[model samples]
Target chain A: MSDDLIGADGRKLTFDANQIRDLLPHRWPMLFVDRAYDVIPGKSGYGIKNVTVSEPYFAGHYPDQSIMPGVLIVEAMAQLTAVVYASAWKEEVADSDEVDTAGRVGYLGAIRQMKFNRLVVPGDQLILKAELGKAFGTLTPVTVQASVGNELVAKGSLTVTERGSGGGNGLQ
Target chain B: MSQSYDELLDQAQARASLNLRVKVLLVDSLGLEIQAELIGDDQPLFGRGLELDSLDTLEIVVMFEEHLSVTISDDDRAAFGSVNKLVDFVVAALGEIPRVEALA
Candidate 1:
């Protein structure tokens, strides 16, 4: 496949569902992001999620109104954050001969000051954006937002523990 | 002319107020279950005291930047020793109790 997805920094800027699958451990019903692009390792990333009526949550979310749950939008943003970190980690290990066979699994340390502006619905594509802040040890501070076109859907800051940091059943 | 006694008293009061603010900020930013007053002014922030880990340190860094308008770089790890140490660092950085408008 002649994939010219490299960005100005010579790092891969785009990832399709297949590429996303290789980085994230989430499977169907939990995997929220369909395409991730504009990924600047260790700094920022953007993602796209095409909302459809066929989503499992839509069946019981309203049963008639079909509004996407706000939490899921935040989840999509978190997944994009995972991409940002995982991509950076990949770059860090790229020059080494070591092969990392572990599937990336990140956990949310805390979801702080999240505000929802509008409800998402079928046919609306969620534009996910995440800006990574400073990282101390395994924890990184990230500001994330999800929007549908020009309308804002949700915005928040999250403390994300990097993949394989070993936090079992606890948020922090 | 040396500083007056009243001026020295005023400076001490200002430092104490900043210490309280920093303690309150630590509790609020870290989502600590305990009250701000419960935290001692000289209590060690990590290990044997508040038992804060690296994640909590990051939270404090963000909190200081947002609320105190002070940057806590890697070299400034010494300030994380205690609440008093953190307040002293802020006072030294800002050269005063951070003004109310600085809080975001």
Candidate 2:
């Protein structure tokens, strides 16, 4: 119900890596989302993940040739959805002190219609977008897409389960 | 032929087609191990029937929106209990079986 997170022009709420860390439970190599922007709280949002050669997976995924795994790209999209859901949860339970909202956790319950259009490599800044779908109890469906520059790299729908209460808001 | 009889025939044919499309969508989107044609119209979609879990149900909801241009709210969750039920919901929402050729 709160529009405080949304900007005046109907755009602009961006989250830095530090801010993202607070909203998501993922960290270290697993934390794929570096930054996010155009967050529309409880609805949809976009995020960025800068893939680099120094990434640990690059060393093993292919010593001869480096390529970001398709599953990781999907994970990035899921993380962005989590951030959107978490922001909405914060607004919904703003006054509730009993719930420890920090480090909210969720798991990828299902993935459907996933199609990888291109291989992501080092130095590619992946733009991830996730749109909220119908909520059935604690399970939330999200339509997600990932792109490098203007070219789409991946697209799919995912079901994410927020741990704790069965509220449709989000994790925690 | 009576006008009512003609209308009933058209309705029956439309329902038949919608049922086929729904089955295809479920198998394709959920990646069911069985063939789409093999799934019985009245068979349960979850648990022991198709072995689909709650997560699959969410995916199925998205498939309905994306493929069929139909919205299945949480309140309509029970409709997803079976393929026949889902097809009925879609038909009711759309007022007709959407032209599958157009969707392709």
Candidate 3:
């Protein structure tokens, strides 16, 4: 329960890409989340997505004019949720060195009440947040909200299942 | 093997938390600025009138992985065109499975 979580520069986890990869299971073009700040496992986490005209999706989304899509907003939320679960796993298993995410994936069970409050333009920075609504080992209930400052963009809740069972996260 | 729209929609919404979480992850992780809203449970979440576009769909494909923990096949494109369709797909895939989160 930290009000202000700091990063390497004592700034915050807001600008840590290396940490992002370690937590998330995504690659280029597909990966939308850029920085996750104010992260507190199993509680709440805040992240950002920077939309740009240079994105490949913009090429055909509408050559004349590029606009950020709505679905992507959902994806960003899911990723942040994964971090919450993953970080929780790390915290729980920190005592024992027995948990690896290699050769595995997290499955999305469902999304509920997804709404697009505004359009994410080429340069707008989307602020995504996740609050672990319900957590029980591997099966967690996640609630997400995406916004740009004070504006609420989208929100939903879904189930998550981490693959390749082993370690402390496994259900009994 | 086709289910009613109502059945499909219910299945989808009952499927996964990451489905919504990953979309949040990518947008913020990659530094993409975007916005999304809640379409009616009965509303169409795809195509004209909706904020989502073609590329937005592609990102959804990626979102499938980051959130659902499932790899969307090439054939899945059409199924996810509508939010209702995606929910149906999710319901069909992971809804039945007894999920217990485990480390890889």
Top-scoring candidate (TM-score): 1
Candidate 2 C-alpha RMSD relative to the actual structure: 4.6
Q: Per-model C-alpha lDDT, please?
A: 0.82, 0.81, 0.61
Give candidate 2 misplaced runs (Cα > 4 Å).
A1-6, A10-12, A95-99, A102-104, A117-119, A166-172, B1-3, B33-37, B95-104
Q: Which regions in candidate 1 have their CA more than 4 angstroms from the true location?
A: A1-4, A8-12, A96-104, A164-172, B1-7, B30-39, B44-56, B73-78, B92-104
- Candidate 2 clashes: the total is 0
lDDT tens digits by residue: candidate 2, B13-80: 77777788788888877777788778899998877888887777777777788888888887888897
lDDT of 1 by residue, A35-146 (tens): 8888988899899999999999998999979999888888899899988877777778888645341244567887876999999999999999999998765677899999
Model 2 achieves a DockQ score of 0.43
Q: Which is the better candidate, 2 or 3, if ranked by DockQ? A: 2
| Winner on lDDT (1 vs 3) | 1
| Best candidate (score: lDDT) | 1
Better of 1 and 2 by DockQ: 2
Q: What is the C-alpha RMSD of each candidate to the true structure, in Å?
A: 4.0, 4.6, 16.0
What is candidate 3's TM-score against the reference? 0.53
Displacement of the residue B66 alpha carbon in candidate 1, Å: 1.2
Please give the lDDT score for candidate 2. Answer: 0.81
Error of 3 at A96 (Å): 6.8
